[model samples]
Target: MAEFIKIYPENPNDKEIHKVVEVLRKGGVIIYPSDTIYTLGCDITNYKAMERVAKIKKIKLEKNTFSIVCNDLSHLSDYTKPIETKTFKILKRSFPGPYTFVLPAVNNMPKAFKKRKTVGIRIPNNNITLEIIKQLGNPLVSTSIYDEDEVIEYTTDPELIYEKWERLVDVVVDGGYGGNIASTVVDLSETNPIVIREGKGSIEVL
Candidate 1:
């Protein structure tokens, strides 16, 4: 069963945060809260952990493209190619929020992201998530927690998520409530930014 760890929405506990990081380091998959919704995440460097996440989701991305959440813009160039001056300015203005920017991937990212030559980078505003990434010292490949039934759609409640995904995931970081929506995905790989999906995030910055 997954470990349900309740965390403060504004200030996550350091001890509990370290425990979450340790799980990821040991190749464990976890369901955690994000800026827009509850998300399932794992160590980006752990291929086996990522495979488990794919199985839990019961879906295979055609290009094997996964969204990786980072702590800040400083690590962007490590996974993706250098951004244009204009693109950097735009991202600087909009990131650390609910925006996912799809940019060209660096030649040496994880296999799943590198082959596609693109990566979806997120710098979520959620504190619990950012602390996890910071302590883990790497990015997390994450996706929204949802089910096949369109009636309920995304899972918003942490207790319910614990009940449903306990066997599938390792941990559930309950950081209060979530929005049952996803972040706005903006593909900045081209000359102009493109909106792939508009969810909880506003498009005013784009």
Candidate 2:
């Protein structure tokens, strides 16, 4: 069973945060809350953990790309190609909120992502997950967890998420209830930014 940790959304406990970071650092996959919904995440550098997540999602990583969650904008260039001035401004305005921007990726990505030409990046406003990413010293591979049932849509209750994903993951951080909606997805890989999916974020900033 996954270790369930209840963290205060407003004020996250450092010790609990460390526990989550440790798990990620040790190649453990976790189900955690974001500003939009509860997400499945693992250390971006952990190829095996990424494989585990891919297996759980029934996805082939080569065919599907996962959005990477960074604590802030400082390390975005590490994963993506050089950002143009306009793109930087747009990112500055849109990030630290519920938005995922798809940008041209660096050629030298992990083996699983070598075939991917673009990558989605997010810097969520949620504090607990941000702090966890900050301590982990790298981005986390983020993918929204969609429930199999149609009625619930996206699972919001942490306890229920744990119950459903406990055996499959290593940790489940209970950061109170999460939202059903996902982050707005904007494709910035082209000359013009396009709103691909309208969700929690407002397009006015774009």
Candidate 3:
């Protein structure tokens, strides 16, 4: 059975937040709320935890690209190559919101999840999620809480999520229903930014 922890969506209890972080540190997969949607996350560096997330989603390791959730813009450099000044300006204005930028992965990135030397990175504005990342001091491997077929399962109730995917994931952090939407995806691997998918964030700002 998956352990479900209730956390304050805005200002999560410090004790509960610590417990959630402990689970991540131990390589446990957790379902947590993000600015855009609820996500399944684990320490990106933990190969076993990453594998568990992949297995639960029925995603082939070779076919799916995983995203890293950084606590802020400064953390982006840890996982991806340096962003150009112009691009950085644009990102600074729009990030900490619902947007994912695909950039070239840094050389030190873990090979288990790197694909074509690129990775998806984002810094969400959610408090609980951000606090957890800040405490961990590194990004977490994250993906939408959905099936491989691209079906989205959005809910705020922990019991509902537990009843549905209890066996699939290890833990559930019930921060409440994040509005049903995925992050806007931008491929910045090229000189020009391309909007691959438009979700919560508006394109006008990008």
Best by TM-score: 2
Best by lDDT: 2
State each model's C-alpha RMSD to the native: 1.4, 0.8, 2.1
Query: What's the distance in Å from true for residue 153, model 3?
Result: 5.4
Instruction: Report, for all candidates in order, the number of backbone clashes.
Output: 0, 0, 1
Ranking by TM-score: 2, 1, 3
In model 2, state the lDDT of residue 66: 88
**Candidate 2 local lDDT, 124-197, one digit each (tens):** 99999899999999999999899989797899999999999999999999999999999999999998899999
For candidate 1, the 10 contiguous residues with the lowest summed lDDT are 57-66
Candidate 3, 89-195: lDDT as tens digits: 77888888889988888888775665548888888889999999988877898888753334554664566777877787778888876668789999888898899
Please list the C-alpha lDDT of all candidates, in the order they appear.
Answer: 0.87, 0.93, 0.82
* Residue pairs with backbone overlap in model 1: none
Task: Locate the minimum summed-lDDT window of 10 residues in model 2.
Answer: 59-68
Show model 2 residue runs off by greater than 4 Å. Answer: none
